[model samples]
Target: MDGSDDKRLDDTLIALRRILRATELYERELAQAAGLTPAKLRVLQILSGRKEGNATPTAMANQMGVRQATVTALVDQLENRGMVRRERSSTDRRQTHVVIAPAGVEALRSAPSALQQHFVANYQKLEAWEQQMILSVLNRVALMLNAADIEAAPVLTIGDIRQDRGRG
Candidate 1:
């Protein structure tokens, strides 16, 4: 690429990285204020959003794009904290399902502000076409960055999976 093209790409990458970093910092602060690690808070967020009482280890692993062992460990930690509980599935005794406890629900509800609330509020104030254009550009940029890591799953947005599963 020419100098200008290279400079433009560099600038875009830097700006995107800054945005990601800011989001992470916000999440960390929010989780800390709620007495939870960022990872634990993420699990609580996922479980609280589910209308169904139990989530299978396989399902949660798939949702998080992590190995079953990692998901189990996360559940183990949360379970010990009384944020979640495990129950044997009625249909299949071998299947252990994870459910959010009332404490988990409260933690998720009371967790500190996320970037989504601020970003979405600002995004919603934009024109419909502008929102569409921004989404399109962002998705393209993400894909470009992930081109070398084709096996990686796309990042899951809040509510995306729930919507896909048709849960109310």
Candidate 2:
């Protein structure tokens, strides 16, 4: 409404843009280093996080918040790369589980999580109250931006924004 309010809004928007840009650049670097696109790498990461390093396409779609068709395509790519294998579920013959191959695990290990390294290192240095305040503010900001419903995993990477927008 006033000059001060306008300035604060502009600054907030700029900071958000910087965060998005940095995330995009970091995603590109991580993908290049791992020799995989961000989306494919994400699929491998998700599979690795599973209890047995395996999951059905439907479950992966749910976890990644993408379409089943998208997960299927990613699985196909990973299979071609020898990063994953599709095995028919023993209990349910109708479903196939995507299992991460040894190579995939190696790749995951080799990929340096730049975002985590940068954020965690700095975040750990913050005071306890400062960390709590930051978490609270970030949660509030996410709610304000209508992003509260986005299913974000512990892993950090810029997800497919176009696909997410389609879901909305």
lDDT of each: 0.69, 0.78
For candidate 1, write residues 1-168 as lDDT tens digits: 999999998998899778878755765566566656545666777777778866887887787776677678778877877999999999999998899999888877777765666777898999999999998987787688775444332232321222212211
- Candidate 1, after superposition: displacement of residue 107 in Å? 1.4
Task: Quote the lDDT for 106 in model 2.
Answer: 82
Clashes of each: 0, 0
For 115-150, candidate 2 gives per-residue lDDT tens digits of 755888999999999999999999999999999988
Model 1 misplaced stretches (Cα beyond 4 Å)? 1-10, 116-168
TM-score of model 2 (CA atoms) = 0.67
Q: Which stretches of candidate 2 lie over 4 Å from their true place?
A: 1-3, 114-168
Clashing pairs in 1: none
TM-score for each model? 0.63, 0.67
